[model samples]
Target chain A: MDFQLSDDQRALRAGVRELLAGRFGRDRMRAALDAATGVDRALWRELGEAGFFALRLPEAEGGVGLGLPEAALLFEEAGRSLLPGPLIATHLVAGSVKGAARGEAVVAVLDAGQPVAHLGEADALLVLAPANAPRAPGGTLRDAAPVRDAAGPVRSADPFTPLWRVTDPVEAGEPLPGAGRLREEGALLAAAEQLGSAARTTEMAVQHAGAREQFGAPIGSFQAVKHLCAGMLVRAELARSAVYAAAVTADPVEIAGAKLLADDAAVRNARDCLQVHGGMGFTWESDVHLHLKRAWLRSGQWLTAAAAEEMLAGDLC
Target chain B: MDLAYTEEEQEFRARLRAWLAAVLPGLPAKPRPDDWPGRRAYDTAWQRMLYDAGYAGLHWPVDAGGRGATPTQHLIFLEETERAGAPYVGANFVGLLHAGPTIAAEGTAEQRARWLPPVLRGDEIWCQGFSEPEAGSDLAALRTRAVRDGDHYVVSGSKIWTSHAEVADWCELLVRTDPAAPRHRGISWLAMEMDAPGVTVRPLRTLAGSTEFAEMFLDEVRVPVSHRVGAENDGWRVTMVTLSFERGTAFVGEVVACRRTLAALAADARRNGRWDDPVLRRRLGRLNAEFRALWRLTQWNVSEAQRAGSGGVPGTGGSVFKLRYSHARQELYEAAAEVLGADSADLDREWVLDRLSSLSYTIAAGTSQIQRNIVAERILGLPKGR
Candidate 1:
């Protein structure tokens, strides 16, 4: 009944956190916000080199053989750093695609019947077919039909996450083995990211509340602001527990539960954090909005709140 | 990171479950919230049953007349007992949870011999005399006074929100022994007789129409100086120890009970056809998820204690779990009320009873406001507010 992270897990978490802090810290994230792709490829390569993309891959496959929990911890760091990219897709794809483990090939997963994320930027796209189909790949993504050049980039809520709609959709090909498992894993990892972002935003809000003074003292001295910060902390920590537990259990119901809490924490914590920063938080110069924007994007990813709720309701029934 | 209990812990749970299964049927049904007499007898019998079976004081050390179970085993005991629909420790709560541990920790040898055994055996009932009318959240500001009078302390002051005071045979009293000293420095912890001369207990009715709490008025109630748990004027630390235990595994049962309530509510929603409403479904689903997270958070804390090899006080995490559980509990009962709609007014329905009593979940132990302050100032390092 121990909940403490093993020394190895702790070291792994600290190592990922330190690496991300040094490589894709707030400053680096801000710089990438307005970049052409809104992603730091150099940092991505560095992460791949550090075995971030290969952590969950079997050691026999020339990769680090860690479990989904370890992978969740690494993605939590990514979320904390607000590292931009199709991180879960890329990491999961590395399991099937060669070169991806080395960060040489960028892979994006297209939700069945939805616009493919990183449609043009990614080197390959993997589409998940419905369960019960034959165990096979949905064809190599690079070989799939592409959208016309006239299809411009769709405006995204998060400036760091640019969306693209594909006009030329590929027909269903071969099905991947246990696509449902992959989807759950993807949701779990995304939840881990949301946990990180939630925690980071909480810290950001608390730091601002302590430093930014109004009236006669720091606004944190006021009950209203203090309660808001406290609420944010609660949301973040609750999501954290859910995320880590799901990582350990890897149960579909637990994963759905984690996604629900993580989405709430990520989105609500960012908004409350913005409120804590006041008018300055409304401006683009403030990173608080960045968190809110990213949270909005992630909430709609792999498993949305609505979808997660549906899964949990099914369990209740 | 393991959440599974040990084989020995599993065996303990199986044994407890079988015992509960066998004994629970023969016992009288649990009494209503207002059925104090019936409940007193039922609860006393249940505690004695538990004590005889070596289930009482499951978390305490063996030398202190407990099973010396690990933190995980203690949690399992709580979860399994609550899951079995057994009665709560009720009036004996203070004795088993608070005074017994305090005696073992800070009391003199004679005090332990005199006080600890009866508490485990359900032969004595205890109440806390800490909060006064003037001191609710800021408990350190308590003005309860106790002046030295040779062999005894002549205590004179009032204490509010003392649970089970009416039924309690003894009181863990906190009084100010030094009026000139700082508020937190002059306090003293004493084991006072509740039935002593010049002592008064006035039962206070709550919104639930239950007298689970009472106000204690002490007009020169003489408590032997030998009853002091610690050195004179050092009661503040002793009080802290007692309060920490109050916030400890006491909630483990509540958490399990809450999970059962949530499950029953979901079942109600389905029965009443309220589960189909997308809005209500989402709300119910979200709540189910929150409850799961809260349960996991508790497990994580217990696991942490096990990993630390420090037998579970929960420290600051206790406040976090309590605050979240309170909100979750209230929200759940409110949703149940919504599900019941007009049927919620039926007092016979258990959910209605829960809805009525849910408000106290946040108010007792420590209010949500106090909890947030602790989380902010202690957990998050937020600046203390004025």
Candidate 2:
């Protein structure tokens, strides 16, 4: 029983992290945040060209034909780089929707009851409607007619993620098969992303605690600060292990549990990271607040805490 | 990579499982038979049964009367044994796990011939005399002294937490042979007879109400210089060898046991009708996740060791595992206690005992604080504490 990644997986992870680091560093992230499009089109195209969205697509379908674990690893880098847009939605619909696999067309999903994020930028949307809802012409993106955009972008707490309330709801798109699988996949990848962010915040907290001194010593030397940093490490690692294992298992309940841990790690680490940075953390100049905001937004995305709670409760009982 | 055991490993596990199933029914059950002699008899009898099945000292070297199992096989032994809920390795632990390995690594030819077979056969129970009243985590700073008196060394000072001291026939002792040298420089490792003159053992009861440990007073107890395992004043290195064994694949049993314990905790919660409570269920789920992580982390550590082979740079990963395992186990039991509430007073003695005993996990090997320091300083390369 080996938990260590294969040599190929390690290389792939290193490649993805380096590529994301080069393309979506802090300055570029800030640029994306300030831009009207809210995403770097060039970088997005590069990701497609590099086969990011096509990772899990079958080799017969002209994709890299990797598994969910590899996809999880990629999203982890996305989370670490704080890459914006509707990532999980686009990734999930990539195989079914034309151009989505190639990353040429951005896709969004009406995420259950939540407002559809990145609606303004998405060329297509994947909606899972109830069995009683009005059916449309087709399920896949190939047959669905191009729908006109009727909603404008609404300001979101996470500037990187733009949201829009559907003013003119589309009643045409067919419901996708295995909505539960899609949610589980999304939750697993989101958990991976959360693990990345949690790990980054831990590093951030440790770095800040080392540099920020108060009483003739580094704050990290103090037990309280040391313990906080330690707690961050523990939470991040715990979530990482869970996320990685869930990716392997691909069980819905396991994924929900993984999401619960990842949510705790990401949210708590971000808050603790802000505390470690003091007043500077609250200002727009510091990126700590960006992480906290993103963590909050992501926690509510695929599997909200309450939803994950209920899923886990049902399983336990 | 793969979580399934190899075919060879599965066969080994199957065989061991069969052996355990065949013999375990005759073994004593919990509540541990209050009489001291009966308890000792039960423990030694179990060890003898294990020895007869060639299960004793399976991890030790082939030349030293062991099976010379691969690292993975050793882990399988631990896992299968624990899963079978076999008797605890109480009296023969030090002899089989620690002293035997140390003797193999450092003892002379004559020492191996004298000690190795007895340890493997459970003829001579062994206990560790490493910790002292003054030295626990800072073990190298122990002040127990052994001065030369002709062909024998007159040992003085005391050793605390000498587990199974009362029943053990021999002790793997560490003593300071030179007071003038630095703390770590003057120590020597010895194989001393527990019944040597001027030796006294007084058992110490822990919070769990078990005299699982004892303090031994040695006043001018004469031990032959020939009993020393390594060169004089080089016991620190020998102690390191023993400690390295402690940090090895022995953790497989404990990890499997922890998973079972967590499962039982979940069952208890469900039985008590608290599983429907979202908050409690969520905590249970989180605990389950943490346990899974620790399991994977252990596997990862084993894989890393395999990749590194013999001379790889030692990591602080053990400290990480220790910290996380203790935290998770403690939380699982504490959560059980909370969920049990007033019912804990009269119901489910196992939960009550486990909740109280779990606190010692953090404090036993190295306190959680010390583990964090190791992580921050050694692994993370943070500034050392003042």
Candidate 3:
């Protein structure tokens, strides 16, 4: 009945936080962002060893069989460190991926267009969404004119496209039932991602506000900064509650509600976090925009906020 | 994390529901018969019945003649009562909600014996005289003086917004005991008997066209020093206990009343023919979502309280719940008015009447601005600067 973490939960949180702090802390995240590079294979393997991606799987399958609440805690830690990878997608796939002997499988979801990996780079690309079956040239990604993305070098909003755009709009594989489609479960997943990113942004704001001084006082000591931080806290707390509640319920209506709440928090908090950092936050080096971009990406990852609300309205009928 | 109630809790709920079904008064419970004279009379009778049945003070202690129920049980009782359109507690809101709790925490053994048993018996009603004409939101600015005179405090001042002062037998009042120090530090919380000499009550007509509140004029009103709830110059702490009652576990009933309004709105929307309209549908849908969030919010708090075992005031969480509930209170009525259309204008239509009464929610209990300020300054730790 307590809303707080139990002693065991706290131990788990401490272990995960330490792991993330060592592997993907600000230094690692900054390096990766600055390099615009490939997956941190060593760190990813460590995470695998730690069973980060196997929390939800049954005990029979090399997993802890923890519920979504536990996964949610791990995911939040992942977000705080701003770890780079399709951690969410990988976890979602870990349950279903059978006979997996992998050279690092990074799962990413896409809508409208799939972001494929460099043809030689990824061992397997899990395509989230396939093009319309009614339309021709649908099963594979098409319309691929290689365009340099504003984000990292290899990551794609659409999981089918390689580091460079391919001729097809689909990833090169047999499409699953929900490659990049909206599902209540998937909606919650996307919302969780946003929740993670939003929480990071608030931390970014808080940390920066404490250290960065202006005129005479820490800008955080200023009332406006306090208000901004407070506002971010309010938004983040409510969104966290919504996401956590929905994740437990598995109700589509709650999922939509959580998605909307989390998306707003993530996007808005990221923006506010950036503003708190002033000019440095807007630059490429601060790693602030990375969170904002990730927030923007995951906000519409499974379904647009508008679409979620509309779907919720439909349920009301 | 699970939202389902325990089997025992559900059985408790069923038992309460069945009891309420058999015992609820046959007469109407709201709007028409429950408004003003008819309503007040019905409420008094019903509360007396509840006291006799040991259902009155669901949240009160066993020694105080209550059922010794958990917070969830208290919640379930209120939920069932509201669903049955049961009579509201007339003249006892202040007594049951604030005064009783304050006295229990800060009252002496003799004081508790003198005051609590009669109040629990529903033989007497109590009023709150905290708000002053000058000090509304700025409650600490109150100038109601309680000068110490031998064995008594000669209180000479006026109290505004004293609910049911003309009818209640006593008033749980806040008065200044020290003028030399700071404002709040100098105050003392007292129990003032309404029948004492040098006290006058004048009914103030409100927008509701009824004297729901009174202005009490005190001229050397003799309050025995023994009647003071706590230490001298520490009324602020005592009043804090009463205010906590409004925002903590006890506030569950009031919030349930709000959820009932939403449920009634939904039913009326379906029964009346407005269900098909897209605008109404969206409004109701949003309300439905908000209602679920609030239900979760309340349950979350209840769960924490249940887990805590020893009771205490909810700090920031209560503020969040109150703010959300107040916002939803207004929205529930607006959606109802749009559904009822022409009938929304009628005072007898409970929802419509509720639509009007809803304004008092944010204004009377705590202003929306005060809540925002509380969130701003305390809960959120945001600075409120010029």
Best by lDDT: 1
Ranking by lDDT: 1, 2, 3
Query: What does candidate 1's lDDT look like per residue over B1-386, in tens digits?
Result: 67677788789889989998998888887687677667667777888898898888887777778777777887888888788888888988888887788888888889988998888888888989989999999999999899999989999999999988877889998899999999889999999998899999899998887787889999999999999999999999886776554323557787777777777777888898888888878888888898888888888777766655534454678888888889898999888888887899998887887788898989888899988888888877877876
The value of fnat for model 2 is 0.40
Model 3 residue A168 lDDT score: 38
Candidate order by TM-score, highest to lowest? 1, 2, 3
lDDT of 2 by residue, B1-386 (tens): 55677788889988998888888787766545235556667777777787898887777778887886766677777777888888767677888888988998889999999999987776788999999999998888899999999999999999999888888899999999999998889999998899999999999998878787899999999999999999999999987776555434656777788778767777887788877676887777667666766776676666666656543235467777788888788888888876786877753467788787787889987788877887777665567765
Better of 1 and 2 by DockQ: 1
Give me the TM-scores for chain A across all models, comma-separated: 0.92, 0.91, 0.80
lDDT digits (tens) for residues A88-155 of candidate 3: 65666665454121314554433444333443333334444422232232122221222223223555
> In model 3, how large is the Cα lDDT of residue A106?
50
Clashing pairs in 2: none
DockQ of 3: 0.26
In terms of lDDT, model 2 sits at 0.78
Q: What fraction of the true interface does each of the listed models get right, in terms of native contacts kept? A: 0.65, 0.40, 0.16
Q: What is the TM-score of chain B in candidate 2?
A: 0.94
Which ranges in model 2 have alpha carbons more than 4 Å from their true place?
A34-37, A128-154, A166-172, A177-180, A210-217, A313-317, B28-34, B246-250, B310-315
